[model samples]
Target: MSLASQRAGLSRLPLRAAAFVVLTCVAILGVSGWREWAARDAVLKGAETEMANVARSLTQHAEDSLDLLDSGVVGVVSRLEMDGTGPSTIAKLGKVLEARKTAVARIHSLAIIDDQGNWLTSPGTIASTLSDDTFFRHHQLSPKRDAYVGHPVKSVLDGQSVVTLSRRFNKPDGSFGGVVLATISAGYLSHFYEQFEIGRNSSVALVHGDGLIIARNPNNERFVGRSVADAPLFRDPSLQRPSGAYRFKSPLDGAQRVSFFKRSGRYPLLVLATVDQDELLAPWRAAAISRMLYVVALVMLIAIIGAVLVRQLQRGQRMAAALVEKEAHFRLLAEGSSDMVTRIGLDERLRYVSPSSNRVVGWRPNQLIGTDALAGIHPEDRPHVQAIVDAMKRGDMDEARLTYRNVHRQKSEVWLESTMRVTRKDNGTVDGVVAISRDITEQKNLETRLETLAIEDSLTGLANRRRFDERLKEEWARAYRDRSSLGLLMIDVDHFKSYNDEYGHPAGDACLRVVAKVIAAEVQRTGDLAARYGGEEFAMLLPNTDAAGCARVGERIRSAVHDAGLVHASNPAACVTLSVGGAACRPAFERTAGTDSLVEAADQALYAAKDGGRDRLMMSGEVTTLLPKASGQ
Candidate 1:
């Protein structure tokens, strides 16, 4: 034991000591990670279980409310319909509804409009004026024994959102008379969602089947009645899931957020939940970053100590001492890293797992180390995931990304995003991949929102021009493929200019929206499209429709507009009516005939309608001479 030997031994001691400390730290991290993971897994599992229960609770509550409303409404409407549409009937029904004010008041006003565009009974004197209103036409179109629920429309009596429910009534002897009606207020239905509790920086809203935001918590006043057509949450194909979380941009603050949706089955209601991104990732991010920082600090300290120790050591003993110390330091670093650093086998199973394994999967590193990683993937997504791995093996991709739902220890589905990079040999051959994943349900939501804004219309809530264009092209292609006719109807609100002149621009805007809704309802075929072409005008594309079908649809739209009866001093054909021009033709792709031709023909016919005295439907062949015969024919 000479001086050199002592120096070598001292250096070896430090190396062994550092290695032991690093290994101990690594084991601690692995154990801590496992423990934390198990706890989080439990919490998430409980949350999922609770969510299902909550959904059931919400469903039950909503069902009770609906049933109560239905029962009360049926009694009143049945009495009103059984009696004649006389003043006595009106007085009796009004008194009955007023007596049941507690229930009826929960909604907006309740009234009965006849099939001939006349109010049979109502809340007040305003009913007399609505006698010739547009809703009457809707009642006429609705069949006997069936109810027609109009889209959200503003009540002329009160400036509020309302859904007009009407059932056609006829004498037992088979004579057509009128309809029984009920108007549901915005406040009544919106109150249901207002009671929900989402996490902080989160929101819950109710959207219509057509993708319009009818109600929302926190900002219902601002966003309610506003259309999210331009929002990615509305238009993206991926966002169509019935109940799942994705990303969205806050309409108020424009911040990216996670959004979850549950589409209502019975009612045209859609529930959405939104949450901020950073809020969800904060804990995991902090833990991962802190661990990396610790590793960096330890590496720096070890490097400095190694340099200093080498300088102090005599030359002859340095090499042997350095080798031993380095091996120990390397081992310590490997064992001490915070992440569950492991060497995977060729079979894609866990050959090694750090103590941190328990933190990630609710199982200790030892428990999972020998198991196949594929076992953790959700059964539904497993095949696709394995396919991606296989592609990676074949050098089809340098790296791959995946987000999958996995069942945790508590049996809760957790969304996970994974990034895997394949390790390669010097010969460029495939080696096992190192995959790292983190929960990113919120991130995916934001991306989904971005995609929605690109597809939907911002106003009128009908599909935007681009979306309409795409749908039109698709419909046209289908019609051509099947050798069926495609019908195009172009509608212009007659004397809209005069309506705007007599009423304010706000009134004009309101009139247009109401008209747009009427058109939407009238064109109810699954493949039909109703879109705002531009200012005061709308377009419809009907697939598999012939000339007669297009004509009937056009007449229904014309009649509905006339029924709305929004006042206009300049129009000769009653209060604000619509003039529609339609064209139906089997498409020919090789003939170079574009959609513009149909639009042009329809527009030309519309001009003829205006020239012939507005509020009529004109087909491509008919000229202004026929407008008079078509008017109220």
Candidate 2:
């Protein structure tokens, strides 16, 4: 234990301590790297799972959309078969197609083609024949009644790409008659796919079983009808399941992505959801690098300060973990939301828009940022929306609920119900508005359809008796207030009962519809109302008309019905004809008379016309007397 021996030992202690610290730092770095790798792998797996879920959801949506179109086509085919392909039947079919086209925004057109590919009924007259079309040929040859979804084709009418949903119709003898086709715009599918909040360079696509890209987000018109059959995704034996995930470089975009695909159970369509490999791994990589740097810093501090900094390092780690968790939670809530979350500056510009903006208005968050918040509002609704914003700015209302029309990027109108709260500073100064908006377009459309159904006749597409009564009362009041004459014409089909017996109930319905159209045509004024009063009976109310004008309109209606030339072997005229009765009056003020008197007068005139001879018009006199026959004797 001399001084030399003691000094050597003390110097060795420092070297030994440095070696031990180096080993400890290496071990810590190894463990930290391993943990980061594991976490990164888990994040990637989670991303794949999320993509799979998105793919499944999009597949189901696409299947549902196709099924809806298929069902509508089938219904039209069934209806056409039940009622033959005569002119009247074709007219009815056209009406059905028109209604379906309006109700379904995705449906570009609903058409019926004959066996020879002639357009039997369509939204508009297009001379193009479907004889060369694959869908038509498939139905013409195949006996299967399954609806066939055709590949994308440029529509001759609008030159836009469309996929056809078609059902084959057979004749009574079970022979192929024609195909009832519904064209769905490919843009609609693209718009739907754009709603998903997949990361940057991500893709959502719908492809045919044959690998034709039917529709895709980030849609390129050139690649839509192209085939990807040779691509690894389709060619890979391991990725053939009904639903699956795979990693591949996209042939179209050349970006490497982890893609999830789902095949529709009901159709030959496949939906793909994908995320770029780099994008998906970006956050985890950044977090890993940050953790690595923090670990290195911790190691340096340990070497310098021994174990004193360990507790502080642990505390920092915990705080960092908590921040990461909070960020993840925030992203989860924000991205998963279906309702759009928005921050609007006091300048009426969009400060921040959530990913859900894509779903609600078909606009990306970036596309909306810094744009005028009220720019997309419908012109008619802008004033109201501005008023609401003004109220919030004035501090009169801290929160408001507003429903307004937002013009979608596709030029369609979407109704959004927004709940907005004014964000205020501590000093009570307005900061901005925070809002949550939900798309209510479908709900609004449903309400509109219900309202239409309530007031429209299902058979003739005219006003029903209820609607007629409502309008009659309204017009009557208006005419009374203005001291103007109101005209009423009661029309009945001649020999309708016999027509039914001879031509069957369906033909009778057809005849009645035609006669109703004729009556409707005769009363073309803005305030005129023509309605199916009852079975085989129709009524027309024309405001600001005298007895002479009423008689002239009645004559026009009778002639039009006769000119329709709807064959009626039972009637003496050898065709479908209408018997008309007319009445005109200037209603007096209270306690003078009721609308019943006008109706009774018209009824009496109608009996006189029928009694004199069918197919004629008779006018009611001023004193409720029946005047001579006007015309159509």
Task: Encode model 2's per-residue lDDT on 1-633: one tens digit a residue.
Answer: 333234435445545655677778888988998899899889878988999999999888888888888888888888878987899999987887888788888777778888998888753633452223888899999999998988888767666678888999999999999988887778888888877887878888889998999888886476688899898767888888798878888888888888788998889998888899998898888888888999989878777774444445555555544433433554577678889988888899997788999988999999999999999999999999899998998888999998999899875789999999998765677868888999998899999999999998889888999999899889888988898898899999988899889989988878877776777677567999888888888889989999999999999889988988888887888998888998988874322556777777898889999999979999988622332122111
- Estimate, for each residue in 13-41, the C-alpha lDDT of model 1 and write its tens digit: 65665566566556666666676677555
Clashing pairs in 2: none
Stretches of candidate 2 off by over 4 Å are 1-332, 588-591, 623-633
Candidate 1 stretches with Cα past 4 Å from truth are: 1-56, 59-63, 103-105, 123-138, 144-149, 155-158, 171-176, 188-197, 229-242, 280-633
The TM-scores, one per candidate, come to 0.39, 0.47
Candidate topping TM-score? 2
lDDT scores in order: 0.66, 0.82
> In model 1, where is the ten-residue run with the lowest total lDDT?
623-632
Full-model lDDT, candidate 2: 0.82
Could you tally the backbone clashes for each prediction?
A: 21, 0
